[model samples]
Target: MSKTLPPAPWTRRDDLARLVAALGIENVRWVGGAVRDTLLDIEVKDIDAATPLLPDEVMARCKEADIRTVPTGIDHGTITAILPTGPVEVTTLRKDVSTDGRRATVAFASEWRDDAARRDFTINALYAHPDTLEIEDYFGGIDDLAARRVRFIGDAHQRIREDHLRILRYFRFQARFGAELDETAEAACAELAETLKGLSRERVAMELLSLLSLPDPSETVARMHRLGVLPVVLPECCKKGVEALKASIETERRESEAPDPIRRLAALLPALRPVAETVAARLRLSRQQRERLTCAAERNEGDVADPRALAYTESRECAIDRLLLQGASTTPLRGWDIPQLPMKGGEIVQRGIATGPEVARTLRAVEARWIAEGFPDRQRVEAILQEFLQKRS
Candidate 1:
């Protein structure tokens, strides 16, 4: 079946075009994400070449061409070849010999048609030429891509059985490509979400985070919740966070700045009522992210009474905290900490204050005075602290 491509003239870097041309797609086609992103007019990442050449043969050909090839998953018939242009992933055509839902056992095949048949989605199954710019669609991927819809290549349940991660990818496709999902697709995703229970948290994290970092993350997550994918993956991700984030778009340009999974995950934290430790442990977040999210959520636990709270809870994440405060209270995210206290502990010592409870009391008084003074300069603060220390003494 013929499939429609995204637009005119797919773009390819010259060196990659030449390196890929060497392999020739006579038996295989360059396919998958590159083709999909090309259709969307977005820059492609990790170029993949589908070939009929066996993994071993592909390695041989690549070596003969003086191109570096990495057996990234040679056992699965996928080899990552390195060229001066960039890293090109070369995956052989394979049929899912068996699938445990959590993982699949694939036996490499020599036919692109059979290989395309084994893939999950029509959009993902389409292949294109980097040189001649010819698009090869075995399924209706071209039409679906045109319609901005995400439908499995064959039976939705069957595809989900092959790999449960496709369930999350269903939303990822929807968010990234603005694809409207069908009933069968949503059902399949919901049905397979339970299978995610047995899958690795790291894998689940990767897919969930990809969905969260998209342009329309809130919408995608809302859909995932409707499909019941939320509790299965990020259980705590729900309406409150979505609502808070919706109006706070200006809080931070997080989508562009902190584009990583951890930052996205952090943004979701303040929306929930769970404690930082609880959220961290449940999501199986990394130590660093767990701490960051915990801190961000804690900072949001109370009203921003003064800059001291901001300085204490959000010293590092001050920008995000400020935005949240401004959104919630119509206040500005910008606030200032009192200037550095000019007087040190020695100044108190020199003032002849006893080194016990009085010293601690005097320091507190000075800090309070500084904050009340609204962050005055070092000279003023020093003079004030000296006067206060003498009074307390």
Candidate 2:
């Protein structure tokens, strides 16, 4: 059975419509995530299409249509059509000729079923006509989508063996779509979990981050832990932290907080610098991400009884992350807000303190006194600076 999707923004784009018309609708069809997401009423981020047209033909058609084209993945039969709406990736239908547990050498085919069969999961194998909104489900993807089941298209182990990353992808898709784990898929993932080590850290991090970005990734992560998958990727994770992650996700929901991968990650590991450093290096985290994670862990170590002190020591954002992690652990959050210090460097300099390190030191002393005295008035601030100057003399 086939169902029609309502007119979505992507479906109604004039530029996309013109490009499809120029290419000849018979040779092209919308495919992949865009089609699947539209059916599920999820906002489609990218529009992907599959065609029987070869790469050269795809380029020639784009030329005739006056649409810009880039051979983003030409060797793999993909061409990026730059339309007014956005870049639409059009790949020629392909069939895998061989696989080496990581990547596949493919042969371009004219059959949509061939392409569908090569996909990782049935839900991802869905396609749709560019104009008619008619869906093409060679497998029982529509039924599986409705059932909220994430299953490998054919043989689970074979599919995973073709690309070890599929193991992580399985859990990620399950988390995002609120799909239950398929038993066969789980068994295959468990058996093949170690194969994830063969994959590049960047690939692993991308999948892991995507999984963490889900509304509530705690359940899926806990399942991953149970299946012995977590240790392979995040060796620092413990049962206690995994359990804390569940409570953290609930707190996020109750407080209407946005999904925060780093904060959730902190909840899933010990709040220690070494642990953060190890995970950051292993995952190739960005410098900013690493700093934030480390700072949050540092803040979590001590009593964050004063938000101002925390803000002075780390940052406001880091303070909030610490509070969230503390809340997750059922620890009381102190310091409602970060109060600004009522002193400045110029004031210290005017108090006859030398420039550079001395001025910085005097400023810190004055700010500490102010914070300790509940942020006193400017008169008191001047008096503190005067007293500090007298002591320096």
Candidate 3:
């Protein structure tokens, strides 16, 4: 009951496999994305092994080999076993103990059948032995993977109730599979769409962003919206910026040089106010990705043309963002870099006859005038400041 391993540039290494076998964990198989990607002819990113070994036993064996052991999800019977080449996620087979639409409560199982039955979809349930290269498809996952159909493992509504995030994952799989959504699965998603709101914003945001990067994100996004999912995660997903981003993803896809996920999200920013950034901050995007999202959002306001006008608007990042939306290569903001102000509040105070708002007003007027004149070098800029100050005096 074994199969030959596929020819991948990267395969599970021998040293780790030998160690795991030395532990005597039965029913060892490479499972999940690693197997699915191998079938899709996509490069394998990482390896995860399912075993019947107890968590403590796996830990003991790893310790014996001097392999780095981490309780990545010890509560769920998963251990992160690190090897020199790469890290492997080793987990015991488990069945769900309970679920409340957001997450599952699981108890480790003794057999592969029990474990495979609890998975979300059929295509993901396929497992492969890294060494013997044996594939175990308990749910006909190999056939489904070959056919590109993303059929749920069991009752669609039951699966959604177990984990609402599966609703988004369903769409992502559809994109990855390049297959039409199964009729039953689509209906079940619509029936339970409202329950998706119960999921965490971070989870929803991650899934939605991934969904948008798919070949036909527009189809999935519009479908999710129709089924009442997008609004709960991002109320702004329906705005002009969102549509623009959707269009941009397709345009970029056509170019044969697809942008990475962050750039794709950069194109899909919801047309939002500065306030929306507060929501983004709350959603917990990475600092760099958040900055990109914020930069794009800030530039969403209005167009910039004049050099001095750029002074009133945003920074170089934002200015460049607006120019990108216009299909331009560079921004006018780069065309004129506004130097730091030479005149200080103290200088203004020394020239001021009062401590009222008028001093501020006069300085702004002078600065605006100078910008309109095309900000000269440091010396000319200083001269312009002096002229304004003299007038104020």
Candidate 4:
């Protein structure tokens, strides 16, 4: 069965048209996520084309067409064509010849079916003709797409054995597209969960972060936890964390807040500095991400009802993250609006206070008082400063 993709901006681009014309329409077709997403009515970000042409041939054709080409993954048969709209990745059809449960050694193939067979999931094994927009489902990808099912293309265990990262990809795709778990895939993942340890921390971190970024990852994560995959990947993730994540997701929906991966991650683990630090280090997160995670975890442990106090210690964004995470906890936090300090350091200095550490100390003291008094009028703040000056004199 074939379906036509509605006219999209990408379909109307001259560069894409020229490339398709140059490569010969039959030799190239849109494949992978772009096709899957278009079929799902989701916005497609990157356009990936599969071709029977070799890497050098692709490069030569692009050069002849005067289209900018970057050999982004040349050895692996990928070239990035810089179209007017954006970069489109084109890859020569390939089949895996060797596998070690962590990586694959592949040999270039001219058959589109072979390429489709090598893909991890049925929904991803789809292809569409460049000109007619006719989809070609070598597997039952169309049926799976219609059902919103995330199932491996062929044997679930074999696909996972070829690349252990597919275990995480399974959950990520399920979170992104499926409404429920595919039992066979789940069972395969459970059997192969230990193989996930062989994957690089960077790869695991990226996949986990992507999973956490979904609209609501609680259900998928709970499924992963039930299958024991979470323990293999992140031993620190606990039952309390899962519950907290569900609550945090609910609060986000109720409040219409943006999805935050770090906050969600913090909610999935104990709100302790050491736990956050350990998770950050294990995932090889950046310094800024590590610091923010630690701050959110630390702030979630104590009283964060006073926005002024939280803002004084942490930035507004950090305070909000802390509040959201803490809100998911069993303890009730005081609800308060973030307030701005009425006085500046220079203003305090002009009041006869020294411009050194003394001025900084006085500003903090006055700010504390203003917060304690619930941010009073400017006259009251002035009176407080004057009193300080008189006492110092």
Best by TM-score: 2
For model 4, how many clashes?
0
Superposed Cα RMSD, model 3: 4.6
lDDT of 2 by residue, 1-393 (tens): 346666788898999888888789888788879988988889999989899999999999889989999999999999999988689999999999999787899999988999999999998998888778888898888888888888899999999889999999999998887566589899999998999989889899889888888888888999999999988999899899898888878877765667888888888888889989889898999999899888777755453466555655677667667866776332223435555666788767776667799888778888888877766788888898888778777
Q: Candidate 3 or 4, higher lDDT? A: 4
Q: In model 4, how large is the Cα lDDT of residue 371? A: 69
Task: Tell me the lDDT of model 4 at 17.
Answer: 93
- In terms of lDDT, model 3 sits at 0.71
Clashing pairs for model 4 are none
Residue 8 lDDT in model 1? 38
* Superior by lDDT: candidate 2 or candidate 4: 4
Name the TM-score of candidate 4: 0.91
What value does the lDDT take at residue 40 in candidate 2?
Answer: 85
Better-scoring candidate (TM-score), 2 or 3: 2
Per residue, candidate 1 scores C-alpha lDDT tens digits across 132-190 of 56787888888887788888988999888888888888888877775566789888888
Worst 10 residues of 3 by lDDT: 325-334
What are the runs in model 1 whose C-alpha is more than 4 Å off?
A: 1-11, 25-28, 249-274, 300-313, 318-322, 325-372
